[model samples]
Target: MRLIQQLIHQAVPDLNGRTFERRSARGIIVDGTKILLIYTERYNDYSFPGGGVAENEDLIVGLHRELAEETGASRTKVLQEFGYIDEYRPHHKPEYDLIHMESYFYVCEVDCDFENVQPEDYEIANGSYPVWIDIAEAIQHNRKVMANQEPSMGFSIARETIVLELVERELLGKASAV
Candidate 1:
């Protein structure tokens, strides 16, 4: 996959520090101008429907698993690789000083009908739920959250917002032009 962007958080001092590397797969499922996203009530922002890929999991497999688990999405077909975001930030776990996260995004198609969603405990606590929202609306909502710097805001907000903008410009833009 191509590299979309590389972000270094304010908390990350240097690249030479000890870090825990994590790889994630994010799905960009678009239907017209609407995009499937996870809205976290606690954070008041929207993000893609995907998560961390297990160490032994293939990226595509991870993407499917995450989509099913988070959004109850079925019959998902990856249309193409969108891109990825490389991010370095402070590790929440005490075992590592920093975290290097590579979030791979794929453009996908999924069945309209959804089943039971099984978001992780933390996600549930954060009031995370799936929804198909207008892409522009999601982007605006995230920008508002970031601008306010709300106490409940999560670290992924910036990354999610940037990717949403890219999707709007690259995917939606092309589609509209056609």
Candidate 2:
């Protein structure tokens, strides 16, 4: 899959410190004009349904597995490669650590028959749940979250906001016309 986007943050990190790199795979699952999103109460924002790709796991397979784990989608069809984003920032709280992350994205559609998603304890405690919302609404809300500037979700929400707009302008545009 070709890289569609690259994002960089200007925050300078400690010259001599630990650098953490995390690679994640996220999904843009849609049905009609509605899109699936993960809502994190801790940040009071929304995000795409995905997480870190396991070592040695193929991108597509990891995404499929993540969808099943995060949204409990019984089945999913990989529609297209959406894009990719590279994020850079100083680690929250731990100032000496610089966090660099690569997020791979894809468009997908989930078939019905979902079970309870198996989420970690933190997710359950934080009220992180999946919800379907209009692409426009998703874009609006994500932008709001970004605008509010919550430290935890600010950067991530900004990236998701971009994806939402693109999916709305491109994918939803075509789907509506059809």
Best by lDDT: 1
Q: Specify the poorest-scoring 10-residue window by lDDT in model 1.
A: 169-178
Top model by TM-score, which number?
A: 1
lDDT of 2 by residue, 8-126 (tens): 65574433467677788898888888888998888777789988887688888888888888899888888888788877767776643777788898988886334658887878888
Q: Candidate 2 local accuracy as lDDT?
A: 0.77
Off by over 4 Å in 2: 13-17, 92-96, 112-114, 150-154, 174-178
Error of 2 at 93 (Å): 7.7
lDDT of each: 0.90, 0.77
How many clashes in each structure? 0, 0
Question: Please, what are the lDDT tens digits per residue for candidate 1 over residues 1-178?
Answer: 7999999999888987678999999999998999999999998999999999998899999999998898887678999999999999998888889989999999999873555788899998989999999988898889888889899988999999889999999998832221
- What TM-score would you give candidate 2 relative to the actual structure? 0.84
Clashing pairs in 2: none
Per-residue lDDT, model 1, residue 6, is: 98
